[model samples]
Target: MNIEFTLNGSVQKVTITSVERALDVLARQCGIKSLSGTCFEGQCGNCLVLFDGKPVYSCLMPAFMLRDHRIETTEYFTKTREYSLLYSELTKEGRSLCSSCHSGIMLMGMVLVRSAPTPTRDEIFRTLSNVHCDSISPDDFADAVLKTIQHLTTARKIP
Candidate 1:
Protein backbone atom coordinates (compact mmCIF):
# COMPACT_ATOMS: atom_id res chain seq x y z
CA MET A 1 0.00 0.00 0.00
CA ASN A 2 0.95 3.62 -0.43
CA ILE A 3 1.33 6.03 2.45
CA GLU A 4 1.16 9.72 1.67
CA PHE A 5 2.86 12.00 4.13
CA THR A 6 4.96 15.11 4.37
CA LEU A 7 8.62 14.49 5.10
CA ASN A 8 10.82 17.38 6.13
CA GLY A 9 8.37 19.79 4.49
CA SER A 10 7.96 17.82 1.32
CA VAL A 11 5.08 15.66 0.28
CA GLN A 12 6.12 12.05 -0.13
CA LYS A 13 4.25 8.96 -1.17
CA VAL A 14 5.81 5.66 -0.34
CA THR A 15 4.83 2.04 -0.85
CA ILE A 16 5.65 -0.05 2.16
CA THR A 17 4.79 -3.30 3.84
CA SER A 18 3.08 -3.47 7.26
CA VAL A 19 5.87 -5.62 8.60
CA GLU A 20 8.41 -2.98 7.63
CA ARG A 21 9.56 -0.59 10.33
CA ALA A 22 9.62 3.17 9.82
CA LEU A 23 13.37 3.25 10.51
CA ASP A 24 14.09 0.91 7.65
CA VAL A 25 11.66 2.68 5.36
CA LEU A 26 13.10 6.07 6.16
CA ALA A 27 16.73 4.95 5.94
CA ARG A 28 16.75 2.31 3.22
CA GLN A 29 13.76 3.36 1.16
CA CYS A 30 13.96 7.11 1.56
CA GLY A 31 17.69 7.50 2.19
CA ILE A 32 17.34 9.18 5.57
CA LYS A 33 20.39 8.03 7.53
CA SER A 34 20.36 10.37 10.50
CA LEU A 35 17.98 8.21 12.58
CA SER A 36 19.68 5.88 15.06
CA GLY A 37 18.43 3.50 17.74
CA THR A 38 20.63 1.00 19.57
CA CYS A 39 17.62 -0.62 21.19
CA PHE A 40 15.27 -1.67 18.44
CA GLU A 41 12.52 -2.27 20.98
CA GLY A 42 12.26 1.50 21.63
CA GLN A 43 14.02 1.70 25.00
CA CYS A 44 16.69 4.03 23.66
CA GLY A 45 15.60 7.37 22.24
CA ASN A 46 18.13 7.07 19.42
CA CYS A 47 15.64 6.68 16.60
CA LEU A 48 13.35 9.50 17.60
CA VAL A 49 11.64 11.58 14.96
CA LEU A 50 8.88 14.15 14.85
CA PHE A 51 5.60 12.50 14.14
CA ASP A 52 3.09 15.31 13.64
CA GLY A 53 5.41 17.66 15.53
CA LYS A 54 5.93 15.24 18.46
CA PRO A 55 8.63 12.74 19.30
CA VAL A 56 8.06 9.14 18.28
CA TYR A 57 10.47 6.25 17.95
CA SER A 58 10.88 5.53 14.28
CA CYS A 59 12.29 2.07 14.86
CA LEU A 60 9.11 0.94 16.55
CA MET A 61 6.59 2.67 14.30
CA PRO A 62 5.07 0.56 11.58
CA ALA A 63 5.56 2.04 8.14
CA PHE A 64 1.93 1.76 7.10
CA MET A 65 0.84 3.77 10.11
CA LEU A 66 2.66 6.77 8.68
CA ARG A 67 -0.14 7.49 6.26
CA ASP A 68 -1.06 11.17 6.31
CA HIS A 69 1.39 11.89 9.12
CA ARG A 70 4.11 14.49 8.92
CA ILE A 71 7.61 13.36 9.76
CA GLU A 72 10.71 15.42 10.34
CA THR A 73 14.24 14.23 11.00
CA THR A 74 17.52 15.85 11.96
CA GLU A 75 17.98 17.13 8.45
CA TYR A 76 15.06 19.48 9.03
CA PHE A 77 16.21 20.33 12.57
CA THR A 78 19.71 21.30 11.42
CA LYS A 79 18.17 23.94 9.21
CA THR A 80 16.18 25.40 12.10
CA ARG A 81 17.36 28.49 14.00
CA GLU A 82 17.01 26.53 17.24
CA TYR A 83 19.52 24.05 15.99
CA SER A 84 21.97 26.83 15.27
CA LEU A 85 21.63 28.11 18.82
CA LEU A 86 21.92 24.59 20.20
CA TYR A 87 25.11 23.98 18.23
CA SER A 88 26.65 27.25 19.35
CA GLU A 89 25.60 26.83 22.96
CA LEU A 90 26.82 23.25 23.14
CA THR A 91 30.12 24.25 21.57
CA LYS A 92 30.54 27.18 23.94
CA GLU A 93 29.78 24.99 26.92
CA GLY A 94 32.25 22.29 25.79
CA ARG A 95 29.47 19.71 25.76
CA SER A 96 29.38 18.02 22.44
CA LEU A 97 26.94 15.16 21.93
CA CYS A 98 27.81 11.89 20.29
CA SER A 99 26.45 11.01 16.86
CA SER A 100 24.49 8.08 18.23
CA CYS A 101 22.02 10.22 20.17
CA HIS A 102 22.21 13.46 18.26
CA SER A 103 18.97 13.16 16.34
CA GLY A 104 16.89 11.94 19.24
CA ILE A 105 18.24 14.35 21.82
CA MET A 106 18.17 17.34 19.53
CA LEU A 107 14.68 16.71 18.25
CA MET A 108 13.32 16.07 21.72
CA GLY A 109 15.07 19.18 22.95
CA MET A 110 13.38 21.19 20.25
CA VAL A 111 10.02 19.84 21.29
CA LEU A 112 10.75 20.63 24.91
CA VAL A 113 11.83 24.16 24.14
CA ARG A 114 8.82 24.82 22.00
CA SER A 115 6.36 23.26 24.40
CA ALA A 116 7.81 24.70 27.58
CA PRO A 117 10.04 27.68 27.06
CA THR A 118 10.67 28.33 30.74
CA PRO A 119 11.46 24.89 32.09
CA THR A 120 13.25 24.82 35.44
CA ARG A 121 16.47 22.84 35.93
CA ASP A 122 14.54 20.23 37.83
CA GLU A 123 12.03 20.05 35.03
CA ILE A 124 14.83 19.89 32.50
CA PHE A 125 16.53 17.05 34.31
CA ARG A 126 13.21 15.30 34.66
CA THR A 127 12.72 15.49 30.94
CA LEU A 128 16.31 14.47 30.32
CA SER A 129 15.75 11.36 32.37
CA ASN A 130 13.20 10.24 29.80
CA VAL A 131 15.74 10.43 27.01
CA HIS A 132 18.03 7.46 27.50
CA CYS A 133 21.53 8.38 26.43
CA ASP A 134 24.55 7.51 28.52
CA SER A 135 26.84 10.07 26.92
CA ILE A 136 24.52 13.07 27.35
CA SER A 137 24.53 14.40 30.89
CA PRO A 138 21.45 15.98 32.44
CA ASP A 139 23.39 19.24 32.72
CA ASP A 140 24.03 19.17 29.01
CA PHE A 141 20.35 18.66 28.34
CA ALA A 142 19.54 21.47 30.75
CA ASP A 143 21.95 23.74 28.95
CA ALA A 144 20.33 22.94 25.63
CA VAL A 145 16.87 23.81 26.97
CA LEU A 146 18.23 27.05 28.39
CA LYS A 147 19.88 27.95 25.12
CA THR A 148 16.78 27.11 23.15
CA ILE A 149 14.61 29.14 25.48
CA GLN A 150 17.04 32.02 25.26
CA HIS A 151 16.97 31.87 21.51
CA LEU A 152 13.18 31.73 21.49
CA THR A 153 12.90 34.63 23.89
CA THR A 154 15.34 36.66 21.88
CA ALA A 155 13.64 35.83 18.64
CA ARG A 156 10.28 36.81 20.11
CA LYS A 157 11.53 40.15 21.42
CA ILE A 158 13.25 41.08 18.17
CA PRO A 159 10.11 42.71 16.85
Candidate 2:
Protein backbone atom coordinates (compact mmCIF):
# COMPACT_ATOMS: atom_id res chain seq x y z
CA MET A 1 0.00 0.00 0.00
CA ASN A 2 1.17 3.45 -0.84
CA ILE A 3 0.61 6.09 1.84
CA GLU A 4 0.85 9.83 1.50
CA PHE A 5 0.70 12.22 4.41
CA THR A 6 2.22 15.29 5.96
CA LEU A 7 4.83 14.51 8.61
CA ASN A 8 5.74 17.43 10.85
CA GLY A 9 4.57 19.70 7.99
CA SER A 10 6.59 17.83 5.35
CA VAL A 11 4.88 15.92 2.61
CA GLN A 12 5.82 12.25 2.59
CA LYS A 13 4.71 9.40 0.42
CA VAL A 14 5.86 5.86 0.89
CA THR A 15 5.01 2.34 -0.19
CA ILE A 16 4.45 0.01 2.75
CA THR A 17 2.60 -3.13 3.65
CA SER A 18 -1.02 -2.61 4.59
CA VAL A 19 -0.41 -4.22 7.98
CA GLU A 20 2.71 -2.22 8.71
CA ARG A 21 2.48 -0.35 11.99
CA ALA A 22 2.54 3.43 11.77
CA LEU A 23 5.44 3.58 14.21
CA ASP A 24 7.60 1.33 12.03
CA VAL A 25 6.68 3.24 8.89
CA LEU A 26 7.56 6.52 10.53
CA ALA A 27 10.79 5.40 12.19
CA ARG A 28 12.12 2.80 9.73
CA GLN A 29 10.85 4.20 6.46
CA CYS A 30 10.74 7.94 7.12
CA GLY A 31 13.63 8.21 9.56
CA ILE A 32 11.40 9.59 12.27
CA LYS A 33 13.24 8.11 15.22
CA SER A 34 11.41 10.20 17.79
CA LEU A 35 8.36 7.98 17.61
CA SER A 36 9.84 5.35 19.87
CA GLY A 37 8.29 1.93 19.99
CA THR A 38 8.80 0.84 23.59
CA CYS A 39 6.02 -1.71 23.47
CA PHE A 40 4.62 -3.00 20.21
CA GLU A 41 1.30 -3.39 21.92
CA GLY A 42 -0.89 -0.43 22.89
CA GLN A 43 -0.03 -0.89 26.57
CA CYS A 44 2.73 1.66 26.32
CA GLY A 45 2.08 5.12 24.97
CA ASN A 46 5.65 5.57 23.74
CA CYS A 47 4.60 5.59 20.11
CA LEU A 48 2.17 8.43 20.59
CA VAL A 49 1.71 10.90 17.72
CA LEU A 50 -0.76 13.53 16.71
CA PHE A 51 -2.97 12.19 13.95
CA ASP A 52 -5.14 14.96 12.49
CA GLY A 53 -4.47 17.07 15.62
CA LYS A 54 -5.40 14.28 18.07
CA PRO A 55 -2.99 12.11 20.03
CA VAL A 56 -2.94 8.47 18.98
CA TYR A 57 -0.67 5.51 19.65
CA SER A 58 1.06 5.00 16.33
CA CYS A 59 1.90 1.42 17.25
CA LEU A 60 -1.80 0.64 17.18
CA MET A 61 -2.46 2.39 13.91
CA PRO A 62 -1.90 0.82 10.51
CA ALA A 63 0.14 2.66 7.91
CA PHE A 64 -2.45 2.33 5.17
CA MET A 65 -5.08 3.86 7.42
CA LEU A 66 -3.08 7.10 7.44
CA ARG A 67 -3.02 7.47 3.67
CA ASP A 68 -4.21 11.07 3.74
CA HIS A 69 -3.76 12.06 7.35
CA ARG A 70 -1.49 14.61 8.94
CA ILE A 71 0.93 13.33 11.57
CA GLU A 72 2.83 15.44 14.07
CA THR A 73 5.56 14.17 16.34
CA THR A 74 7.75 15.55 19.14
CA GLU A 75 9.80 17.41 16.57
CA TYR A 76 6.80 19.48 15.57
CA PHE A 77 5.72 20.04 19.19
CA THR A 78 9.15 21.37 20.17
CA LYS A 79 8.76 24.16 17.63
CA THR A 80 5.54 25.45 19.10
CA ARG A 81 5.53 28.21 21.74
CA GLU A 82 3.38 26.28 24.23
CA TYR A 83 5.60 23.22 24.17
CA SER A 84 8.75 25.32 24.31
CA LEU A 85 7.48 26.99 27.47
CA LEU A 86 6.73 23.66 29.06
CA TYR A 87 10.07 22.29 27.96
CA SER A 88 11.90 25.19 29.54
CA GLU A 89 9.96 24.87 32.78
CA LEU A 90 10.60 21.16 32.89
CA THR A 91 14.32 21.76 32.45
CA LYS A 92 14.56 24.37 35.17
CA GLU A 93 15.56 23.31 38.71
CA GLY A 94 16.85 19.99 37.39
CA ARG A 95 13.30 18.88 36.84
CA SER A 96 13.57 18.25 33.15
CA LEU A 97 15.34 14.92 33.19
CA CYS A 98 15.50 13.24 29.81
CA SER A 99 15.07 9.51 29.39
CA SER A 100 13.49 7.08 26.96
CA CYS A 101 10.10 8.10 28.37
CA HIS A 102 10.56 11.88 28.19
CA SER A 103 9.46 12.24 24.59
CA GLY A 104 6.18 10.43 25.09
CA ILE A 105 5.46 12.17 28.39
CA MET A 106 6.17 15.57 26.92
CA LEU A 107 4.08 14.81 23.89
CA MET A 108 1.17 13.69 26.03
CA GLY A 109 1.48 16.74 28.25
CA MET A 110 1.41 19.02 25.22
CA VAL A 111 -1.74 17.39 23.97
CA LEU A 112 -3.39 17.62 27.37
CA VAL A 113 -2.40 21.24 27.91
CA ARG A 114 -3.58 22.20 24.43
CA SER A 115 -6.91 20.51 25.02
CA ALA A 116 -7.37 21.75 28.56
CA PRO A 117 -5.29 24.78 29.34
CA THR A 118 -6.66 24.93 32.87
CA PRO A 119 -6.92 21.31 33.73
CA THR A 120 -7.40 20.33 37.34
CA ARG A 121 -4.83 18.29 39.22
CA ASP A 122 -6.83 15.13 38.72
CA GLU A 123 -7.21 15.85 35.07
CA ILE A 124 -3.49 16.30 34.76
CA PHE A 125 -2.83 13.05 36.60
CA ARG A 126 -5.34 11.22 34.43
CA THR A 127 -3.71 12.59 31.29
CA LEU A 128 -0.30 11.39 32.40
CA SER A 129 -1.45 8.02 33.73
CA ASN A 130 -0.38 6.19 30.60
CA VAL A 131 3.14 7.53 30.76
CA HIS A 132 6.02 5.80 32.56
CA CYS A 133 8.66 8.41 33.27
CA ASP A 134 11.16 6.86 35.64
CA SER A 135 12.84 10.15 36.54
CA ILE A 136 9.68 11.98 37.57
CA SER A 137 7.26 11.23 40.35
CA PRO A 138 3.50 11.69 40.29
CA ASP A 139 3.77 14.83 42.35
CA ASP A 140 6.43 16.16 40.03
CA PHE A 141 4.28 15.52 37.02
CA ALA A 142 1.33 17.26 38.62
CA ASP A 143 3.50 20.21 39.49
CA ALA A 144 4.71 20.45 35.92
CA VAL A 145 1.20 20.48 34.56
CA LEU A 146 0.15 23.08 37.09
CA LYS A 147 3.15 25.20 36.20
CA THR A 148 2.42 24.93 32.52
CA ILE A 149 -1.16 25.98 33.05
CA GLN A 150 -0.08 28.90 35.23
CA HIS A 151 2.52 29.94 32.70
CA LEU A 152 0.03 29.88 29.86
CA THR A 153 -2.50 31.83 31.89
CA THR A 154 0.05 34.42 32.83
CA ALA A 155 1.27 34.74 29.26
CA ARG A 156 -2.23 35.40 28.07
CA LYS A 157 -2.71 38.14 30.63
CA ILE A 158 -1.91 41.75 29.67
CA PRO A 159 0.14 43.60 32.24
Candidate 3:
Protein backbone atom coordinates (compact mmCIF):
# COMPACT_ATOMS: atom_id res chain seq x y z
CA MET A 1 0.00 0.00 0.00
CA ASN A 2 1.07 3.55 -0.73
CA ILE A 3 0.76 5.97 2.17
CA GLU A 4 1.11 9.72 1.95
CA PHE A 5 1.32 11.98 4.96
CA THR A 6 3.20 14.94 6.35
CA LEU A 7 6.15 13.66 8.39
CA ASN A 8 8.00 16.22 10.50
CA GLY A 9 6.52 18.90 8.20
CA SER A 10 7.62 17.25 4.98
CA VAL A 11 5.21 15.62 2.54
CA GLN A 12 6.28 12.02 2.18
CA LYS A 13 4.88 9.14 0.18
CA VAL A 14 6.07 5.62 0.74
CA THR A 15 5.06 2.18 -0.46
CA ILE A 16 4.89 -0.17 2.50
CA THR A 17 3.22 -3.45 3.25
CA SER A 18 -0.08 -3.18 5.05
CA VAL A 19 1.28 -5.22 7.92
CA GLU A 20 4.41 -3.15 8.46
CA ARG A 21 4.42 -0.99 11.56
CA ALA A 22 4.50 2.81 11.19
CA LEU A 23 7.64 3.06 13.37
CA ASP A 24 9.61 0.84 11.02
CA VAL A 25 8.52 2.77 7.96
CA LEU A 26 9.31 6.10 9.58
CA ALA A 27 12.66 5.11 11.02
CA ARG A 28 14.02 2.79 8.36
CA GLN A 29 12.41 4.12 5.22
CA CYS A 30 11.64 7.73 6.00
CA GLY A 31 14.85 8.29 8.02
CA ILE A 32 13.16 9.42 11.22
CA LYS A 33 15.42 8.06 13.94
CA SER A 34 13.78 9.88 16.85
CA LEU A 35 10.88 7.44 16.80
CA SER A 36 12.79 4.88 18.81
CA GLY A 37 11.60 1.28 18.85
CA THR A 38 12.31 -0.75 21.96
CA CYS A 39 9.74 -3.26 23.18
CA PHE A 40 7.57 -2.98 20.03
CA GLU A 41 4.76 -4.27 22.27
CA GLY A 42 3.34 -0.85 23.16
CA GLN A 43 4.46 -1.28 26.76
CA CYS A 44 7.33 1.11 26.23
CA GLY A 45 6.47 4.66 25.25
CA ASN A 46 9.61 4.98 23.14
CA CYS A 47 7.74 4.54 19.88
CA LEU A 48 5.35 7.38 20.61
CA VAL A 49 4.32 9.79 17.85
CA LEU A 50 1.72 12.49 17.62
CA PHE A 51 -0.90 11.12 15.24
CA ASP A 52 -3.13 13.96 14.15
CA GLY A 53 -2.03 15.86 17.30
CA LYS A 54 -2.59 13.09 19.86
CA PRO A 55 0.17 10.83 21.01
CA VAL A 56 0.00 7.20 19.87
CA TYR A 57 2.35 4.25 19.95
CA SER A 58 3.56 3.97 16.39
CA CYS A 59 4.83 0.44 16.91
CA LEU A 60 1.27 -0.72 17.42
CA MET A 61 -0.14 1.30 14.49
CA PRO A 62 0.20 -0.20 11.04
CA ALA A 63 1.47 1.78 8.09
CA PHE A 64 -1.91 1.73 6.38
CA MET A 65 -3.53 3.17 9.48
CA LEU A 66 -1.66 6.41 8.80
CA ARG A 67 -2.51 6.59 5.14
CA ASP A 68 -4.45 9.81 5.44
CA HIS A 69 -3.45 11.19 8.83
CA ARG A 70 -0.78 13.60 9.92
CA ILE A 71 2.06 12.10 11.96
CA GLU A 72 4.33 14.25 14.08
CA THR A 73 7.29 12.65 15.78
CA THR A 74 9.87 13.87 18.28
CA GLU A 75 11.71 15.58 15.45
CA TYR A 76 8.80 17.91 15.00
CA PHE A 77 8.83 18.73 18.69
CA THR A 78 12.41 19.93 18.44
CA LYS A 79 11.35 22.53 15.87
CA THR A 80 8.42 23.91 17.84
CA ARG A 81 8.71 26.96 20.10
CA GLU A 82 6.67 25.41 22.88
CA TYR A 83 8.77 22.31 22.99
CA SER A 84 11.93 24.37 22.80
CA LEU A 85 10.96 26.27 25.93
CA LEU A 86 10.04 23.07 27.71
CA TYR A 87 13.34 21.52 26.73
CA SER A 88 15.28 24.50 27.95
CA GLU A 89 13.50 24.48 31.29
CA LEU A 90 13.97 20.76 31.74
CA THR A 91 17.67 20.99 31.01
CA LYS A 92 18.26 24.04 33.16
CA GLU A 93 16.72 22.30 36.15
CA GLY A 94 18.99 19.27 35.72
CA ARG A 95 16.00 17.12 34.80
CA SER A 96 17.93 15.85 31.82
CA LEU A 97 20.23 13.89 34.13
CA CYS A 98 18.26 10.76 33.38
CA SER A 99 19.97 10.26 30.06
CA SER A 100 18.29 6.96 29.28
CA CYS A 101 14.67 7.99 29.81
CA HIS A 102 15.11 11.74 29.31
CA SER A 103 13.68 12.02 25.81
CA GLY A 104 10.51 9.98 26.33
CA ILE A 105 9.75 11.40 29.74
CA MET A 106 10.50 14.93 28.62
CA LEU A 107 8.21 14.55 25.62
CA MET A 108 5.46 13.07 27.76
CA GLY A 109 5.85 15.81 30.35
CA MET A 110 5.75 18.54 27.72
CA VAL A 111 2.57 17.15 26.17
CA LEU A 112 0.89 16.72 29.51
CA VAL A 113 1.85 20.21 30.63
CA ARG A 114 0.54 21.75 27.42
CA SER A 115 -2.76 19.86 27.54
CA ALA A 116 -3.26 20.23 31.27
CA PRO A 117 -1.40 23.25 32.45
CA THR A 118 -2.41 22.91 36.07
CA PRO A 119 -2.43 19.15 36.50
CA THR A 120 -2.56 18.06 40.11
CA ARG A 121 0.34 16.28 41.74
CA ASP A 122 -1.50 12.98 41.48
CA GLU A 123 -2.18 13.61 37.80
CA ILE A 124 1.48 14.33 37.26
CA PHE A 125 2.35 11.07 39.02
CA ARG A 126 -0.03 9.14 36.79
CA THR A 127 1.43 10.66 33.65
CA LEU A 128 5.00 9.92 34.69
CA SER A 129 4.20 6.39 35.82
CA ASN A 130 3.82 5.25 32.23
CA VAL A 131 7.43 6.20 31.70
CA HIS A 132 10.14 3.65 32.58
CA CYS A 133 12.70 6.11 33.79
CA ASP A 134 13.53 4.51 37.12
CA SER A 135 16.42 6.83 37.61
CA ILE A 136 14.09 9.80 38.00
CA SER A 137 12.67 10.24 41.46
CA PRO A 138 9.00 11.04 41.98
CA ASP A 139 9.97 14.30 43.67
CA ASP A 140 12.14 15.25 40.73
CA PHE A 141 9.30 14.56 38.30
CA ALA A 142 6.92 16.60 40.41
CA ASP A 143 9.39 19.43 40.54
CA ALA A 144 9.75 19.35 36.76
CA VAL A 145 5.98 19.43 36.32
CA LEU A 146 5.66 22.37 38.66
CA LYS A 147 8.48 24.17 36.94
CA THR A 148 6.92 23.60 33.54
CA ILE A 149 3.63 24.99 34.77
CA GLN A 150 5.41 28.06 36.05
CA HIS A 151 7.14 28.55 32.73
CA LEU A 152 3.91 28.25 30.79
CA THR A 153 2.13 30.59 33.14
CA THR A 154 4.82 33.23 32.78
CA ALA A 155 4.97 32.84 29.02
CA ARG A 156 1.21 33.27 28.75
CA LYS A 157 1.38 36.49 30.76
CA ILE A 158 4.16 38.01 28.66
CA PRO A 159 1.94 38.39 25.59
Candidate 4:
Protein backbone atom coordinates (compact mmCIF):
# COMPACT_ATOMS: atom_id res chain seq x y z
CA MET A 1 0.00 0.00 0.00
CA ASN A 2 1.14 3.54 -0.69
CA ILE A 3 1.00 5.81 2.30
CA GLU A 4 1.82 9.46 2.81
CA PHE A 5 2.84 10.99 6.10
CA THR A 6 4.88 13.75 7.64
CA LEU A 7 8.18 12.36 8.87
CA ASN A 8 10.55 14.60 10.77
CA GLY A 9 8.92 17.67 9.24
CA SER A 10 8.97 16.24 5.72
CA VAL A 11 6.03 14.84 3.83
CA GLN A 12 6.87 11.41 2.49
CA LYS A 13 4.90 9.20 0.18
CA VAL A 14 6.15 5.64 0.12
CA THR A 15 4.96 2.19 -0.80
CA ILE A 16 4.86 -0.42 1.94
CA THR A 17 3.31 -3.82 2.47
CA SER A 18 0.19 -4.03 4.58
CA VAL A 19 2.07 -6.07 7.13
CA GLU A 20 5.09 -3.79 7.23
CA ARG A 21 5.80 -2.31 10.63
CA ALA A 22 6.31 1.41 11.15
CA LEU A 23 9.82 0.72 12.35
CA ASP A 24 10.67 -1.10 9.14
CA VAL A 25 9.19 1.65 7.02
CA LEU A 26 11.11 4.30 8.95
CA ALA A 27 14.46 2.54 8.70
CA ARG A 28 14.00 1.35 5.12
CA GLN A 29 12.01 4.09 3.44
CA CYS A 30 12.86 7.08 5.61
CA GLY A 31 16.38 5.96 6.56
CA ILE A 32 15.94 6.38 10.32
CA LYS A 33 18.66 4.40 12.10
CA SER A 34 18.36 5.82 15.59
CA LEU A 35 15.51 3.42 16.36
CA SER A 36 16.80 0.06 17.63
CA GLY A 37 16.19 -2.24 20.54
CA THR A 38 16.80 -5.79 21.79
CA CYS A 39 13.11 -6.57 21.85
CA PHE A 40 10.98 -5.90 18.79
CA GLU A 41 7.95 -5.95 21.05
CA GLY A 42 6.64 -2.76 22.64
CA GLN A 43 8.15 -3.79 25.96
CA CYS A 44 11.47 -2.19 25.01
CA GLY A 45 11.50 1.55 24.39
CA ASN A 46 14.27 1.30 21.81
CA CYS A 47 11.87 1.84 18.94
CA LEU A 48 10.07 4.82 20.46
CA VAL A 49 9.12 7.75 18.27
CA LEU A 50 6.87 10.77 18.47
CA PHE A 51 3.65 9.73 16.78
CA ASP A 52 1.32 12.71 16.49
CA GLY A 53 3.34 14.58 19.14
CA LYS A 54 3.21 11.62 21.53
CA PRO A 55 5.70 8.84 22.09
CA VAL A 56 4.75 5.43 20.73
CA TYR A 57 6.62 2.21 20.07
CA SER A 58 7.18 2.17 16.37
CA CYS A 59 7.90 -1.55 16.31
CA LEU A 60 4.28 -2.40 17.03
CA MET A 61 2.75 0.35 14.90
CA PRO A 62 1.61 -0.85 11.50
CA ALA A 63 2.42 1.15 8.41
CA PHE A 64 -1.25 1.73 7.73
CA MET A 65 -1.54 3.58 11.03
CA LEU A 66 1.21 5.98 9.94
CA ARG A 67 -0.83 7.35 7.10
CA ASP A 68 -1.22 11.14 7.43
CA HIS A 69 0.35 11.00 10.86
CA ARG A 70 3.22 13.19 11.98
CA ILE A 71 6.17 11.13 13.17
CA GLU A 72 9.27 12.59 14.80
CA THR A 73 12.38 10.59 15.51
CA THR A 74 15.42 11.45 17.59
CA GLU A 75 17.21 12.49 14.45
CA TYR A 76 14.71 15.29 14.00
CA PHE A 77 14.25 15.96 17.69
CA THR A 78 17.98 16.54 18.20
CA LYS A 79 17.53 19.79 16.30
CA THR A 80 15.09 21.22 18.82
CA ARG A 81 15.67 23.27 21.97
CA GLU A 82 13.97 20.63 24.08
CA TYR A 83 16.51 18.07 22.89
CA SER A 84 19.31 20.39 23.88
CA LEU A 85 17.94 20.81 27.36
CA LEU A 86 17.37 17.08 27.85
CA TYR A 87 20.70 16.08 26.28
CA SER A 88 22.72 18.38 28.46
CA GLU A 89 20.84 17.30 31.55
CA LEU A 90 21.13 13.59 30.75
CA THR A 91 24.87 13.84 30.07
CA LYS A 92 25.77 15.87 33.11
CA GLU A 93 28.23 14.42 35.65
CA GLY A 94 29.99 12.11 33.18
CA ARG A 95 26.86 10.06 32.52
CA SER A 96 26.66 8.33 29.16
CA LEU A 97 24.09 6.39 27.13
CA CYS A 98 24.10 4.07 24.15
CA SER A 99 22.85 5.48 20.88
CA SER A 100 19.55 3.61 20.91
CA CYS A 101 18.71 4.19 24.55
CA HIS A 102 20.05 7.70 24.37
CA SER A 103 17.56 8.49 21.66
CA GLY A 104 14.80 6.83 23.62
CA ILE A 105 15.64 8.60 26.85
CA MET A 106 15.99 11.97 25.21
CA LEU A 107 12.67 11.64 23.46
CA MET A 108 10.95 10.46 26.62
CA GLY A 109 12.48 13.27 28.61
CA MET A 110 11.19 15.81 26.12
CA VAL A 111 7.72 14.34 26.36
CA LEU A 112 7.75 14.32 30.13
CA VAL A 113 9.08 17.81 30.46
CA ARG A 114 6.72 19.20 27.85
CA SER A 115 3.65 17.57 29.29
CA ALA A 116 4.48 18.38 32.89
CA PRO A 117 7.13 20.95 33.51
CA THR A 118 7.05 20.11 37.20
CA PRO A 119 6.47 16.38 37.36
CA THR A 120 7.15 14.58 40.60
CA ARG A 121 10.16 12.33 40.97
CA ASP A 122 7.89 9.31 40.83
CA GLU A 123 6.43 10.51 37.55
CA ILE A 124 9.90 11.05 36.17
CA PHE A 125 10.93 7.60 37.31
CA ARG A 126 7.84 6.11 35.80
CA THR A 127 8.57 7.75 32.47
CA LEU A 128 12.21 6.73 32.58
CA SER A 129 11.27 3.15 33.36
CA ASN A 130 9.69 2.94 29.93
CA VAL A 131 13.16 2.99 28.38
CA HIS A 132 14.82 -0.20 29.50
CA CYS A 133 18.52 0.59 29.55
CA ASP A 134 21.34 0.25 32.05
CA SER A 135 23.19 3.36 30.96
CA ILE A 136 21.89 5.37 33.90
CA SER A 137 20.60 4.61 37.35
CA PRO A 138 17.01 5.41 38.30
CA ASP A 139 18.09 8.17 40.64
CA ASP A 140 20.29 9.65 37.99
CA PHE A 141 17.45 9.63 35.48
CA ALA A 142 15.15 11.39 37.91
CA ASP A 143 17.80 13.93 38.71
CA ALA A 144 18.29 14.84 35.08
CA VAL A 145 14.58 14.97 34.46
CA LEU A 146 14.09 17.27 37.39
CA LYS A 147 16.89 19.46 36.21
CA THR A 148 15.40 19.69 32.76
CA ILE A 149 12.07 20.58 34.25
CA GLN A 150 13.67 23.26 36.33
CA HIS A 151 15.31 24.79 33.30
CA LEU A 152 12.08 24.80 31.33
CA THR A 153 10.13 26.26 34.20
CA THR A 154 12.70 29.00 34.64
CA ALA A 155 12.68 29.76 30.94
CA ARG A 156 8.93 30.04 30.82
CA LYS A 157 9.03 32.68 33.52
CA ILE A 158 11.19 34.95 31.39
CA PRO A 159 9.75 37.55 29.01
Best by TM-score: 4
Clashes of 4: 0
Question: Between the candidate structures 1 and 3, which one is better when assessed by lDDT?
Answer: 1
**Predicted structure 2, TM vs. truth:** 0.87
- The RMSD (Cα, Å) of candidate 3 is 2.4
Give a tens-digit lDDT track for model 3, residues 113-134. Answer: 7775488888778777666677
What TM-score against the true fold does each predicted structure earn? Answer: 0.87, 0.87, 0.82, 0.90
User: Candidate 1's residue-wise lDDT over 131-155, tens digit each?
Assistant: 6877767787788779778877988
lDDT of 3: 0.75
Candidates sorted on TM-score, descending: 4, 1, 2, 3
Per candidate, the number of residue pairs that clash is 0, 0, 0, 0
Candidate 4, residues 134-153: lDDT per residue as tens digits?
A: 88888887888778778877
User: lDDT values of the candidates?
Assistant: 0.79, 0.80, 0.75, 0.85
Error of 2 at 141 (Å): 1.6
In model 3, which runs have C-alpha deviations exceeding 4 angstroms? 92-100
